[model samples]
Target: MSEDTETVSVHGREFQRTSLDEGVYYAPVAFDDREESRLTAQHEIVSRIFGDGLFSPRIPVGEPEAILECGYGGGDWAVQCADEFEDCEGMRVRRLSSRPMSRQMDRPENLDLVAHNLNDPLRDPEIFKANHYDLIHSRFVFPGIKSGRWNGYIRDMRLLLRPGGWVQIMEYLPIIQSHNGRLTDQNAVRRWWQEYQGAMADMDRDPRIGRRLKRLLLDNRYRDVEVDIVQLHIGDWSKNETQASIGRDSVEMIGDLLESLGLWPFTSKLGWTAARFEDLMQEVRAELQNVELNLYIEL
Candidate 1:
């Protein structure tokens, strides 16, 4: 409700404007309580992927002076890190590679939220002092990062980290795999990804960069880099209760996100009419409900 904030509704889904991205045409996700609620659920789903903890084992154990979270949406993970390490400094950047959500959480005194674009140069000593951070984490941001800039991003993370500082990222492969080989051109999942990836390709972003993170990190001179892949079931088809719950949520989340993920990319870049997009979405939704499909996403 700030004077600077404006709400924009597209196809009934609302987005708030805190500030325009580096590209004037692109705006981050809305900064509303409802958006925060969605981000909270997303954080839960992500936490389950890392064994229900905010800090991953791949990250170093002991607390350091400063920590940075790239693409911190809703500020949930940053706030949790601040609470756990009250004495440590927690810094979060908005709109790096995720939807921009609210930064108005009741965070601890140690946590600082700032609006920053990660695509910019990090080697600039004035902006990011070299070798300053102890730990850095980014999740699910590969979609927003341009393909050519991945190396620059890795270099920035490496330069910003202090000696032996750890960096961890979690991203998912865009392609959906089905055990039954049901993800054909006739199926919704494959069709959706085809359109989705095509649109991202138009924007020069690679949606399937999850499997290459380890190589990128090692090539960038990051020591002890680790990649952990978690597969999410498409529906409530898992024997384990926790994973089943995550799967159920995942299905709902995908249903909810179909528009946000595809609207602009498919319409503006790929020439998808609204009606055609809606029909495609419906097809994808139908496939999501098929328990026999056994579709999975690798993260």
Candidate 2:
């Protein structure tokens, strides 16, 4: 970590904060052990939602020789993908992240972790050469990337992709809705979401980036762009056992996200007191536990 990026303690939790001029990384959440665990669990939940697949079947490539994952929090996806293609000859899985990764004894040999900021161009041209990657993937990275820089981010990723290479981006819609029309104006979750979206927009981060990804790719001249929507039920409302289990896990994940993702932006950017934010979250959690509400989020 550089002087531009420093850890600050807030509400007894340590969070990484960046100078506005740095433009390397900016997120409300902390990049600590708890966050790492949450990210890994989130990866598993998302993988299960997509049938445990790493990439879409529609992707043209087969057994990609070179893979790149941008904003790979905890490197969970990269590590798993590397393990999946470990036997393939000349296979390489490169992960780009702002956080420094400690050496893992069980790390896959084909996986390479790089500390780089997504907001800026690749620092090392030799390593991140043009047309070098077979596939470029990112998930939930919009929060850290400035709204004005999305075009450059896409262009840079395009530059790194080999001919006919595919880029997969997964993001949350950042709004929670009720499938049964039970969510109302009085709901704390809905209020919180509205304020959160405004705060993010004020910070130049697009809260609805998930819905715009296809347009972004198309505008970037990418072909065969496909968008997949995954519905995440918050509580144990599903009739199916697997879906119910996933819902339970989602409740926990969303709770963690409410605190980690909302704390800084809510208090600092939105002028909310810490106590006010905490009270709002308590109400939001209560609402999330109501299965009859049928709350869900789109990804």
Candidate 3:
């Protein structure tokens, strides 16, 4: 393994990392590959969400010389792109708190990983060169950044991309909507989302940022901006194996993340004790187990 590949320990977890800002933000997810099955499943879900091809009309099919994936969790998307576009160089950036980089031993030589936080603008002299990239992308990065920073982040993306270059951002809408108007206030998952929004509100992060990306991009003067919203079933409710698998993966993943994504923020910002949070989660888990619940999320 290369020297940089060595894992570092933080709070009993082992992952490679770069220096971080003193008190920037907290990340609830762990970076261990053992906990990353959901991330792989997420990429598949996203591909299905857009019917494949990375969801940007401005980006062409042929290889581009440069690509950047901000918040490049697990590097799956970057590696896949590297393999498809053999001559293209791909750079991925992530914060230290996102856990570890992907562990693909046979990764392409053209793919590079860097530890850089997206909450701030690109500052490295070489990376900051104006109009230096052919494409830029990010997925599920809202939780780790302050709500107000997205405008600045999009502005940075605009500066990094060359003329006619593409920029894509994918985020889970985080709201539970039902097709038949069955998702009532009494539903546990619906209640869970309510609590989540409340906690995020207290923390000043916006869980609804998914719906605002189009306006943010256009406000930054990005031309030809397009937003694709994909609706996915919450669990095995969809009967189709692929959709069920995607839903199952999502439920399982979020189940694993409940503590980080749910408990911590709620406890810190809303003043709920762990015991009290668990009580609420018990009700929420019961709702998750109902196949007939039929909840769907927009991506």
For each candidate in turn, give its C-alpha RMSD to the true structure in angstroms. Answer: 3.0, 2.5, 3.9
Best by TM-score: 2
Candidate with the larger TM-score of 2 and 3 = 2
In angstroms, the error of model 3 at 265 is 0.7
Tens digits of lDDT, candidate 2, 57-125: 677658788888887776778888888888777677665655544224256888876656777775477
**Model 3: clashing residue pairs?**
31-99
Please give the RMSD of candidate 1 to the true structure.
Answer: 3.0
Instruction: State in Å the error of residue 122, model 3.
Output: 2.0
The C-alpha local distance difference test score for the whole of candidate 3 amounts to 0.66
| Regions more than 4 Å wrong, model 2 | 1-6, 17-31, 102-106
lDDT of 3 by residue, 1-299 (tens): 54334454433334343322232344433355543665676676677655565655545745577777787666667778777777544443222223345565345777766655666667577555578777777778777677888899889889988787788788877776776677788776777788888888777678899988999999989888777687777777786887887787577555544434675566656778767778787876666556676767787
Sort order, TM-score high to low: 2, 1, 3
As a TM-score, model 3 comes out at 0.81
- Local accuracy of candidate 1 as per-residue lDDT tens digits, 1-299: 64234656655455544323233223236465555666777788888877888868666558678787887767788778777877654443322433454656676777665545566665555445578788788876765677887888988889888888888788868677886786678777777888888878877777888878888998998877766778888787888888888888888665555555676677667887878888988888888888788877788
lDDT of 3 at 219: 93
List ranges where model 3 is wrong by over 4 Å: 1-25, 52-59, 89-99, 103-107, 236-245, 257-260
Cα distance off (Å), candidate 3, residue 250: 3.8
Clash list (residue pairs), candidate 2: none
